[model samples]
Target chain A: MSTVSTSIAPAAAPARTSAPADNTSFSVDFSDIGRSFTAKPERGAARGSTVAPRPVLRDVSLTVQPGEVLAILGTSGCGKSTLLRIAGGLDEPSTGSIRIDGSPLNGIDARCAVGFQEPRLLPWRTIADNVALGLPRRIGRAEGKSRVAALLELVGLTSFADHRPRAVSGGMAQRASLARALARNPGVLLLDEPFGALDALTRLKMQDLLLDVHAAAPTTILLVTHDVDEALQLADRIILLGADDDADDMAGGRTGATIVQELVVPGGRPRDRGSAELAELRGRLLAGLGIDRHGQARGVAATHTIPHFPY
Target chain B: MTQTQIPKPGTAAAVRPARRPIRLTSRRGFVIFGGALLPLAILLVWQLSITLGVVSVSQLPSPAMVFLAAIDLYERGQLTLYVAISTQRVLIGFAIGASLGVAAGALVGLSRGANVLLSPTLGAIRAVPSLAWVPLLLLWLGFGEQSKITLVAIGAFFPVYTTVSLALRHVDQHLVEAGRAFGLGGIRLFTAVQLPAVIPSVISGLRLALAQAWLFLVAAELLGASMGLGFLLSESGGNGRIDRIILAIVLLAVIGKITDAVVGIFEKWANKKWA
Candidate 1:
């Protein structure tokens, strides 16, 4: 446990009670990240299919700056989740590099937190107990309980704090999960479609909650999603993923295949949600995603870079 | 939908009442009470049927007849002596068997390399039932208390091993990865995450192993030894004292019930506290 504390002790900025650092920049450089393995998979002596495990991710490289949310937009089966895992140190790439805050990330660290699309709260724990799980041991039981109370309150789940995960609604479970991720006071958050499991209204509410958390901590966040409108609404920049051998170019290291271009916007925060810039950007991303006016997939598609211009 | 409030929204009173009588509808209490009633109901019916002469006197004795024999044995001090002998054998055997089984289960579960090495050997050992071990135990340890305990240990070993191994194989990959990511590996990972997660399954296995221990308890006693419940049953059977035999069988049932209840309690406590 102390080793974990040491591993996450970033020299650039200490973890803070409220304000971490006045610094406004953070960045990650993932270079040539890839992985492969081999296994029999079956456990029979008589007959078993043996095959060389293939690569789940290739030399995927990207850079994410601090206080900026990079929405990684990708289609299913294009290894978006795999890329996210590699970047978070949840997976070791077969060949490549990953640096967070200029320090190499070899394995999981306390400075980073990840939330999956599924609301993966521990079933046996109440919402508050789930939140307390990630808190540092120095807090002790009483303070840990209080910290859990505060996080649950922040997530608008004070009433459900004592409720087991099984008793809560899907939206409530996701909120509890978000609160758990927040408990570690992470600097870099990896959200894999954090609100994908929620209905539209709940998703919007979760989006607002996420934005507020970002405002409070001002942490560097890398959010992944397949939804183009979501990218337009939340990200400082959107990197579109395509299923091609040259997909590494859109990530800023290579240039061969890209459908939706990567473009950086100049916005700091609090961009107008209903402004024409956002709407126009949404339309372009929607087109890139091949979604039409009826909120359905479009027949026509185009590859134009996503820019972070604020109006 | 305003649905959250209509449910008589109370303070955390819903979960806090530590001494509150658990609702019968709640699964925990229901299982507890239902479990308690089964044997009592069986005894009541048996007592009633025997009193009514519904069964032949040779085949079925009234519950009272067994109770009277138990009192007679108690007065003679045979009950205490036999019960003590059986209890000691069970405890020692179960301890040895469970520890070995857990060690083997862990070895099998963690490494593919280890599984390939151990599976065929365990397969042959598991195929041989505890009853089949009686002759070997008598030959190995002599026809005394030692043989009896060895039989009980063999009975306990296989179930614990099989269940623990199966549960380990099906361990949640996500939790393992989470533990690894958190810098927990080698021993710490097993103690904190892997072990806790596998506990519910292990408890079930222990429960099964304990029942097997009881199953072999009689066989162990019957094979050798001059005391214990199983020996008492055989001794009574020799004299055609069916009432004493029935009493001993009833005693075995009672001990089995008690051990099961204890294991069940431990399982519930483990799941609630750690799981």
Candidate 2:
């Protein structure tokens, strides 16, 4: 075990030194991001058929400033998770480039940590060990131990440090997951519906916990959620991915997901829920999601009355 | 959905304690007592039938006759020697076969390359019964300890290998993704995530393999063993000592049952730990 720790020490050394400067150096840039795959044709289409390429994400361009919380909202099948995965360097975009801290991302983005929808805790390991997984290899044992303890405390899972993931509640498990993500002290934190599976009450608690964590860490966050209210609550800006307007622009009768609308939230942290600004923006965002209360294509028009919210 | 407080429908019933089920640990004595009842009743019927001449004493000896035969074998020191010899063979064979099976299963389960190269060949060998291996093994290794032990090992290997490999393949995908997200790859991922996840299944496989090992032991000893319980059984059959044959059969069943119970205990513990 000593030998194993020593072997990993050198590989993780740079990350430890670079972590403190995270907030200033952190930014995520997604330029002309496009991903497509060749899938088999639908079952009823034809026998031995070769279908056109299916594009999941297309022309998704955005720059997330350091310490900013950007929410990507869309319905299922809109490739919002795919966009986050690409940003995290888990998957590569077929058409464009992603940059982290102004450098082009080539492989797994060590500086960007991801929290998936499921808590994704390893069932065998204790919560601390799962959290310790993100610790850089080069850090000494003492430092790693301290960091893990601190993170568990930060996520309010100090009592569960020695407990396995299976022994903890779902909300607690997700908190451990958040602690694990923060363990690396990554410059960019990519969350793909981190609270989607929780109960409404638990989701609210987690959203509050996320706010507290951000206040402490101040890292750039990219949250992917379908919940309009959640985006209004947590994000400084919200981007919607959907089909392009022009039928001619859509190949194979349907277009890939793109950044069709962007909304800049008006209020600061801990804003009132009953505020009229948020209420009107919520209506416009809902309309953009194709649920117009007026029963017409008035999504763009709805946001015009909200003076503070910018597109 | 009205909030009227008129004893709120099933509130009284819901608040009442349901009938408490007996816990397993607390019921251990009861379980043992219940289990012994059937065998005791069978033994009584056997003894009564023999006394009444319902079962011919020559063909089907009473339970007392078998007990006396066991004591006779014990006095001659044959009982201990036979049991010891058979047990040593099983322990050695099980150790060898179980280790190899687990290693092969891990290799094949974790690697598509190993599965492609080795699965078809292993699958064919696995299909061959323990009895089928007896003749070939005897021809190769002779009517000695080697042939019998090898036969037992072969019987034990297939179940462990097949169950473990299949279980490993079916490990939850969500856990695998979690491992990947945490910078775990290759061997680390397998050990930290996949292996622990499949431990319950592996323990179940071990229990099955152990049972298979014992089944093959009898077949192996019957073909050629000079001092095993199986040998005793055959020798008694030739000598027409029906009681001694029954004694050997009873000993085999008792040992098999005890060993299976031991493995079952481990299986239960593993499931609790890894559940």
Q: Considering only chain B, report the TM-score of each candidate against the true chain B.
A: 0.85, 0.89
Q: Per-residue lDDT tens digits of candidate 2, residues B72-191?
A: 999999999999998888878887888789889999998889999999999998888778888888899998899988988887888889988999999998888767766778898888
Classified by CAPRI criteria, candidate 1 counts as acceptable
Fnat values, one per model, are 0.30, 0.40
- Fnat of candidate 1 is 0.30
Per-residue alpha-carbon lDDT of candidate 1 for residues A1-311, written as tens digits (9 for 90 to 100): 11112111122124343443322234677787665433443434222235645444554677766556788887675567777787677766667788877888867766677787877666666778767766654557887777778778888999988888888899998998888777766667788888887777778778888877776666677888987666766777788765455454553443322224575543544555556555556666665555664432442223323433451
lDDT for each residue of candidate 2 in A1-311, tens digit (9 for 90 to 100): 00111111121212222335433326778999998755763524442347666778888899877667899998788899999988877777879898887889866767888999999887767899989988865779999999999999988999889999888999999999999888888878999999988877788789989988887767778999998878988888899998876843654456688998997787676556567677778877887788755633332323322223231
Model 1 scores a C-alpha lDDT of 0.72
Q: After superposition, how far is residue B187 of candidate 1 from its true place, in Å?
A: 3.4
Which ten contiguous residues of candidate 2 chain B have the minimum total lDDT? B4-13
Q: Per-candidate TM vs. native?
A: 0.78, 0.87
Any runs in candidate 2 off by more than 4 Å, and if so which?
A: A1-25, A41-51, A247-252, A294-311, B1-26
Best TM-score among the predictions, by candidate number: 2
Give model 1's DockQ, 2 decimals.
0.25
Error of 2 at B213 (Å): 0.2
How many clashing pairs per prediction, in order?
Answer: 8, 0
